[model samples]
Target: MLPVGAGAIGTQARTADSPVMRMLDELNHPATAAHILAERTMLHMLRGHCNSPIAGYADTTPDGRMSLFGMVFKRDGSAFVRSHAWGDPSDPATLGSRVAADLLHQGAMKLIDATRK
Candidate 1:
Protein backbone atom coordinates (compact mmCIF):
# COMPACT_ATOMS: atom_id res chain seq x y z
CA MET A 1 0.00 0.00 0.00
CA LEU A 2 1.12 3.53 -0.69
CA PRO A 3 1.62 5.95 2.15
CA VAL A 4 -0.88 8.80 2.11
CA GLY A 5 1.00 11.12 4.43
CA ALA A 6 2.38 11.63 7.90
CA GLY A 7 0.19 12.05 10.97
CA ALA A 8 0.59 14.20 13.99
CA ILE A 9 0.04 13.19 17.60
CA GLY A 10 -1.07 15.70 20.17
CA THR A 11 -2.23 15.81 23.77
CA GLN A 12 -4.95 17.79 25.45
CA ALA A 13 -6.02 18.45 29.00
CA ARG A 14 -9.44 19.21 30.42
CA THR A 15 -8.21 22.53 31.66
CA ALA A 16 -5.29 24.83 30.89
CA ASP A 17 -4.47 24.91 34.58
CA SER A 18 -3.46 21.27 34.71
CA PRO A 19 0.14 20.74 35.78
CA VAL A 20 0.41 17.65 33.62
CA MET A 21 -0.52 19.67 30.57
CA ARG A 22 2.12 22.23 31.40
CA MET A 23 4.72 19.51 31.72
CA LEU A 24 3.71 18.00 28.45
CA ASP A 25 3.84 21.37 26.77
CA GLU A 26 7.30 21.93 28.16
CA LEU A 27 8.53 18.67 26.76
CA ASN A 28 7.33 19.57 23.31
CA HIS A 29 10.08 19.95 20.69
CA PRO A 30 10.03 23.43 19.15
CA ALA A 31 11.21 22.33 15.70
CA THR A 32 8.74 19.50 15.43
CA ALA A 33 5.95 21.68 16.76
CA ALA A 34 6.76 24.37 14.22
CA HIS A 35 6.69 21.84 11.40
CA ILE A 36 3.34 20.38 12.37
CA LEU A 37 1.74 23.68 13.23
CA ALA A 38 2.86 25.20 9.96
CA GLU A 39 1.32 22.38 7.95
CA ARG A 40 -1.90 22.49 9.95
CA THR A 41 -2.17 26.22 9.54
CA MET A 42 -1.83 25.87 5.76
CA LEU A 43 -4.61 23.31 5.67
CA HIS A 44 -6.78 25.51 7.86
CA MET A 45 -6.24 28.52 5.63
CA LEU A 46 -7.15 26.47 2.61
CA ARG A 47 -10.30 25.24 4.39
CA GLY A 48 -9.16 21.71 3.72
CA HIS A 49 -11.09 18.81 5.22
CA CYS A 50 -10.94 15.04 5.04
CA ASN A 51 -12.88 15.05 1.77
CA SER A 52 -10.75 17.69 0.14
CA PRO A 53 -7.95 16.78 -2.26
CA ILE A 54 -5.35 18.75 -0.41
CA ALA A 55 -1.89 17.82 0.83
CA GLY A 56 0.77 19.72 2.71
CA TYR A 57 4.06 19.15 4.49
CA ALA A 58 6.36 21.34 6.53
CA ASP A 59 9.88 20.85 7.79
CA THR A 60 12.88 22.67 9.16
CA THR A 61 15.92 23.13 6.96
CA PRO A 62 19.35 22.28 8.24
CA ASP A 63 19.99 25.96 8.74
CA GLY A 64 16.84 26.11 10.94
CA ARG A 65 14.49 27.85 8.50
CA MET A 66 10.94 26.55 8.19
CA SER A 67 9.78 25.34 4.78
CA LEU A 68 6.24 24.57 3.72
CA PHE A 69 5.00 22.76 0.64
CA GLY A 70 1.33 22.56 -0.26
CA MET A 71 -0.77 21.15 -3.08
CA VAL A 72 -4.36 20.95 -4.24
CA PHE A 73 -5.25 18.24 -6.67
CA LYS A 74 -8.18 17.46 -8.88
CA ARG A 75 -10.22 14.51 -7.78
CA ASP A 76 -9.15 12.40 -10.72
CA GLY A 77 -5.51 13.37 -10.30
CA SER A 78 -5.47 15.01 -13.71
CA ALA A 79 -4.23 18.36 -12.48
CA PHE A 80 -2.88 20.12 -9.42
CA VAL A 81 -1.47 23.34 -8.06
CA ARG A 82 1.50 23.55 -5.75
CA SER A 83 3.39 26.15 -3.77
CA HIS A 84 6.48 26.20 -1.61
CA ALA A 85 8.12 28.76 0.62
CA TRP A 86 10.72 29.14 3.34
CA GLY A 87 10.47 31.39 6.35
CA ASP A 88 11.61 31.93 9.88
CA PRO A 89 11.03 28.94 12.15
CA SER A 90 9.76 31.15 14.96
CA ASP A 91 6.86 32.31 12.74
CA PRO A 92 5.57 29.20 11.04
CA ALA A 93 2.03 30.47 10.59
CA THR A 94 3.25 33.19 8.27
CA LEU A 95 5.03 30.62 6.14
CA GLY A 96 1.91 28.50 5.99
CA SER A 97 -0.21 31.49 5.07
CA ARG A 98 2.20 32.59 2.41
CA VAL A 99 2.27 29.20 0.72
CA ALA A 100 -1.48 28.79 0.97
CA ALA A 101 -2.00 32.20 -0.56
CA ASP A 102 0.37 31.30 -3.36
CA LEU A 103 -1.57 28.16 -4.13
CA LEU A 104 -4.84 30.05 -3.97
CA HIS A 105 -3.51 32.68 -6.31
CA GLN A 106 -2.59 29.93 -8.75
CA GLY A 107 -6.17 28.63 -8.91
CA ALA A 108 -5.99 25.99 -6.22
CA MET A 109 -9.62 26.72 -5.39
CA LYS A 110 -10.68 25.52 -8.82
CA LEU A 111 -9.11 22.14 -8.19
CA ILE A 112 -10.58 22.05 -4.71
CA ASP A 113 -14.05 22.95 -5.97
CA ALA A 114 -13.94 20.34 -8.69
CA THR A 115 -13.31 17.66 -6.05
CA ARG A 116 -16.58 18.45 -4.31
CA LYS A 117 -18.74 17.60 -7.28
Candidate 2:
Protein backbone atom coordinates (compact mmCIF):
# COMPACT_ATOMS: atom_id res chain seq x y z
CA MET A 1 0.00 0.00 0.00
CA LEU A 2 1.05 3.57 -0.60
CA PRO A 3 1.56 4.71 2.96
CA VAL A 4 3.16 7.97 1.87
CA GLY A 5 0.33 8.82 -0.50
CA ALA A 6 -2.18 7.67 2.03
CA GLY A 7 -0.57 9.94 4.60
CA ALA A 8 -0.84 12.87 2.24
CA ILE A 9 -4.51 12.14 1.71
CA GLY A 10 -5.07 11.84 5.45
CA THR A 11 -3.34 15.19 5.98
CA GLN A 12 -5.56 16.83 3.42
CA ALA A 13 -8.57 15.15 4.95
CA ARG A 14 -7.92 16.97 8.22
CA THR A 15 -7.79 20.43 6.72
CA ALA A 16 -9.92 23.05 8.46
CA ASP A 17 -13.50 23.67 7.26
CA SER A 18 -13.79 20.34 5.45
CA PRO A 19 -16.73 18.15 6.45
CA VAL A 20 -14.47 15.40 7.71
CA MET A 21 -12.26 17.89 9.47
CA ARG A 22 -15.26 19.51 11.12
CA MET A 23 -16.60 16.17 12.27
CA LEU A 24 -13.23 15.18 13.67
CA ASP A 25 -12.89 18.49 15.40
CA GLU A 26 -16.31 18.19 16.97
CA LEU A 27 -15.48 14.68 18.09
CA ASN A 28 -12.29 15.85 19.82
CA HIS A 29 -10.19 13.92 17.31
CA PRO A 30 -8.04 16.84 16.30
CA ALA A 31 -5.12 15.02 17.85
CA THR A 32 -3.90 13.83 14.48
CA ALA A 33 -1.99 17.05 13.95
CA ALA A 34 -0.53 16.76 17.42
CA HIS A 35 0.53 13.20 16.77
CA ILE A 36 2.18 14.27 13.55
CA LEU A 37 4.05 16.98 15.35
CA ALA A 38 5.30 14.55 17.97
CA GLU A 39 6.40 12.00 15.41
CA ARG A 40 8.12 14.64 13.30
CA THR A 41 9.88 16.00 16.34
CA MET A 42 11.15 12.55 17.24
CA LEU A 43 12.30 11.91 13.71
CA HIS A 44 14.11 15.21 13.59
CA MET A 45 15.98 14.35 16.78
CA LEU A 46 16.98 11.03 15.26
CA ARG A 47 18.02 12.63 12.00
CA GLY A 48 15.59 10.46 10.07
CA HIS A 49 13.28 11.06 7.17
CA CYS A 50 10.24 9.48 5.55
CA ASN A 51 12.56 7.53 3.26
CA SER A 52 14.69 6.29 6.14
CA PRO A 53 14.28 2.95 7.84
CA ILE A 54 13.07 4.82 10.88
CA ALA A 55 9.53 4.88 12.16
CA GLY A 56 7.60 6.47 14.98
CA TYR A 57 4.09 6.76 16.32
CA ALA A 58 2.59 9.03 18.94
CA ASP A 59 -0.80 9.36 20.54
CA THR A 60 -2.53 10.83 23.53
CA THR A 61 -4.71 9.15 26.07
CA PRO A 62 -7.99 10.53 27.31
CA ASP A 63 -6.17 11.36 30.53
CA GLY A 64 -3.96 13.79 28.59
CA ARG A 65 -0.73 11.82 28.53
CA MET A 66 1.21 11.44 25.31
CA SER A 67 3.00 8.19 24.43
CA LEU A 68 5.54 7.80 21.70
CA PHE A 69 7.37 4.92 20.08
CA GLY A 70 10.44 5.20 17.91
CA MET A 71 12.40 2.60 15.96
CA VAL A 72 15.48 2.54 13.81
CA PHE A 73 16.44 -0.30 11.48
CA LYS A 74 19.44 -1.41 9.54
CA ARG A 75 19.30 -1.29 5.77
CA ASP A 76 19.25 -5.07 5.35
CA GLY A 77 16.69 -5.36 8.13
CA SER A 78 19.06 -7.46 10.17
CA ALA A 79 19.01 -5.33 13.25
CA PHE A 80 16.89 -2.68 14.97
CA VAL A 81 16.15 -0.92 18.22
CA ARG A 82 12.98 0.67 19.49
CA SER A 83 11.90 2.66 22.49
CA HIS A 84 8.77 4.12 24.05
CA ALA A 85 8.10 7.07 26.32
CA TRP A 86 5.26 9.02 27.84
CA GLY A 87 4.77 12.63 28.84
CA ASP A 88 2.23 15.40 29.00
CA PRO A 89 0.13 15.51 25.85
CA SER A 90 0.51 19.27 25.68
CA ASP A 91 4.28 18.79 25.40
CA PRO A 92 4.51 16.09 22.77
CA ALA A 93 7.86 17.37 21.61
CA THR A 94 9.33 16.33 24.93
CA LEU A 95 7.71 12.93 24.72
CA GLY A 96 9.27 12.45 21.29
CA SER A 97 12.66 13.64 22.40
CA ARG A 98 12.65 11.25 25.31
CA VAL A 99 11.69 8.31 23.15
CA ALA A 100 14.47 9.12 20.73
CA ALA A 101 16.89 9.31 23.62
CA ASP A 102 15.83 5.89 24.82
CA LEU A 103 16.30 4.42 21.39
CA LEU A 104 19.70 5.99 21.04
CA HIS A 105 20.74 4.63 24.40
CA GLN A 106 19.70 1.21 23.16
CA GLY A 107 22.29 1.53 20.39
CA ALA A 108 19.79 2.42 17.67
CA MET A 109 22.26 4.91 16.27
CA LYS A 110 24.89 2.22 15.97
CA LEU A 111 22.59 0.02 13.96
CA ILE A 112 21.71 2.87 11.69
CA ASP A 113 25.37 3.65 11.18
CA ALA A 114 26.17 0.04 10.45
CA THR A 115 23.68 0.10 7.64
CA ARG A 116 25.74 2.76 5.92
CA LYS A 117 28.88 0.60 5.88
Candidate 3:
Protein backbone atom coordinates (compact mmCIF):
# COMPACT_ATOMS: atom_id res chain seq x y z
CA MET A 1 0.00 0.00 0.00
CA LEU A 2 1.09 3.57 -0.61
CA PRO A 3 2.29 5.26 2.59
CA VAL A 4 0.69 8.51 3.75
CA GLY A 5 3.85 10.63 3.87
CA ALA A 6 6.00 9.67 0.94
CA GLY A 7 8.30 12.60 1.64
CA ALA A 8 8.35 12.04 5.37
CA ILE A 9 10.21 8.75 5.05
CA GLY A 10 13.52 9.96 3.72
CA THR A 11 13.83 12.53 6.49
CA GLN A 12 16.02 10.01 8.24
CA ALA A 13 17.71 8.82 5.10
CA ARG A 14 20.85 10.75 5.91
CA THR A 15 21.36 8.97 9.22
CA ALA A 16 24.21 6.48 9.17
CA ASP A 17 21.94 4.05 11.01
CA SER A 18 18.17 3.91 11.36
CA PRO A 19 16.65 5.12 14.62
CA VAL A 20 13.89 2.53 14.38
CA MET A 21 16.47 -0.16 13.91
CA ARG A 22 18.41 1.18 16.89
CA MET A 23 15.25 1.10 19.00
CA LEU A 24 14.38 -2.38 17.87
CA ASP A 25 17.89 -3.53 18.67
CA GLU A 26 17.13 -2.72 22.28
CA LEU A 27 14.06 -4.96 22.15
CA ASN A 28 13.66 -8.70 22.16
CA HIS A 29 13.64 -8.83 18.38
CA PRO A 30 16.58 -6.83 17.12
CA ALA A 31 16.39 -8.27 13.65
CA THR A 32 12.76 -7.39 13.36
CA ALA A 33 13.43 -3.85 14.44
CA ALA A 34 16.24 -3.62 11.96
CA HIS A 35 13.93 -4.66 9.16
CA ILE A 36 11.48 -1.94 10.07
CA LEU A 37 14.33 0.52 10.26
CA ALA A 38 15.44 -0.50 6.81
CA GLU A 39 12.03 0.35 5.46
CA ARG A 40 12.20 4.14 5.77
CA THR A 41 8.79 4.27 4.17
CA MET A 42 7.24 2.49 7.13
CA LEU A 43 9.27 4.45 9.65
CA HIS A 44 8.09 7.74 8.20
CA MET A 45 4.53 6.49 8.62
CA LEU A 46 5.00 5.81 12.35
CA ARG A 47 4.91 9.14 14.16
CA GLY A 48 3.62 7.81 17.47
CA HIS A 49 5.71 8.24 20.63
CA CYS A 50 4.13 5.64 22.89
CA ASN A 51 6.41 2.85 23.97
CA SER A 52 4.86 -0.49 24.96
CA PRO A 53 4.98 -4.14 24.09
CA ILE A 54 2.52 -5.20 21.40
CA ALA A 55 1.26 -8.80 20.95
CA GLY A 56 1.62 -10.41 17.57
CA TYR A 57 2.56 -13.35 15.33
CA ALA A 58 3.57 -13.92 11.73
CA ASP A 59 1.32 -15.85 9.37
CA THR A 60 3.07 -18.06 6.87
CA THR A 61 1.67 -18.94 3.49
CA PRO A 62 1.84 -22.45 2.07
CA ASP A 63 4.55 -21.25 -0.24
CA GLY A 64 6.58 -19.97 2.75
CA ARG A 65 5.70 -16.31 2.68
CA MET A 66 5.14 -14.37 5.89
CA SER A 67 2.96 -11.33 6.52
CA LEU A 68 3.36 -9.17 9.60
CA PHE A 69 0.41 -7.47 11.25
CA GLY A 70 0.07 -5.10 14.19
CA MET A 71 -0.76 -1.61 15.45
CA VAL A 72 1.20 1.40 16.76
CA PHE A 73 0.40 3.82 19.57
CA LYS A 74 0.95 7.52 20.11
CA ARG A 75 1.74 9.27 23.38
CA ASP A 76 -1.87 10.43 23.69
CA GLY A 77 -2.91 6.75 23.48
CA SER A 78 -3.96 6.80 19.88
CA ALA A 79 -2.96 3.99 17.53
CA PHE A 80 -2.78 3.19 13.83
CA VAL A 81 -2.30 -0.07 11.95
CA ARG A 82 1.19 -1.33 11.08
CA SER A 83 2.04 -4.12 8.67
CA HIS A 84 5.01 -5.52 6.70
CA ALA A 85 6.31 -8.26 4.47
CA TRP A 86 8.17 -11.19 6.05
CA GLY A 87 9.64 -12.57 2.92
CA ASP A 88 9.26 -16.26 1.82
CA PRO A 89 5.84 -17.38 3.04
CA SER A 90 7.07 -20.65 4.59
CA ASP A 91 10.39 -19.62 6.04
CA PRO A 92 10.57 -19.47 9.81
CA ALA A 93 13.54 -17.12 9.79
CA THR A 94 11.58 -14.57 7.79
CA LEU A 95 8.87 -14.74 10.45
CA GLY A 96 11.01 -13.30 13.24
CA SER A 97 10.66 -9.59 12.45
CA ARG A 98 7.03 -9.94 11.37
CA VAL A 99 6.22 -11.64 14.66
CA ALA A 100 7.91 -8.89 16.64
CA ALA A 101 6.01 -6.17 14.80
CA ASP A 102 2.76 -8.04 15.47
CA LEU A 103 3.45 -8.30 19.19
CA LEU A 104 4.47 -4.67 19.55
CA HIS A 105 1.67 -3.30 17.40
CA GLN A 106 -1.06 -5.32 19.16
CA GLY A 107 0.03 -4.25 22.62
CA ALA A 108 0.10 -0.62 21.54
CA MET A 109 -3.34 -0.99 19.96
CA LYS A 110 -4.84 -2.32 23.19
CA LEU A 111 -3.52 0.65 25.15
CA ILE A 112 -4.94 3.09 22.64
CA ASP A 113 -8.25 1.23 22.57
CA ALA A 114 -8.52 1.17 26.36
CA THR A 115 -8.02 4.91 26.77
CA ARG A 116 -10.55 5.69 24.07
CA LYS A 117 -13.22 3.57 25.76
Q: lDDT for every model?
A: 0.80, 0.70, 0.42
Question: How do the residues 19-114 of candidate 3 rate in per-residue lDDT, one tens digit apiece?
Answer: 865754455443343334433323333322233323233444566455544444443545444555556533444444454455445564455445
Clashing pairs for model 2 are: none
Any runs in candidate 1 off by more than 4 Å, and if so which? 1-5
Candidate number with the higher lDDT (1 or 2): 1
Cα misplacement distance, residue 92 of candidate 3 (Å): 4.5
Top candidate on TM-score is 1
Q: Superposing all C-alpha atoms, what RMSD in Å does each candidate have to the true structure?
A: 2.7, 4.8, 11.9
TM-score of 3: 0.29
Candidate 2 lDDT, 38-93, residue by residue in tens: 77777777776455678777768777888777778877878778887778877777
Which 10 residues in a row give candidate 1 its minimum summed lDDT? 1-10
Off by over 4 Å in 2: 1-29, 115-117
The TM-score-based order of candidates, best leading, equals 1, 2, 3
lDDT of 3 at 67: 53
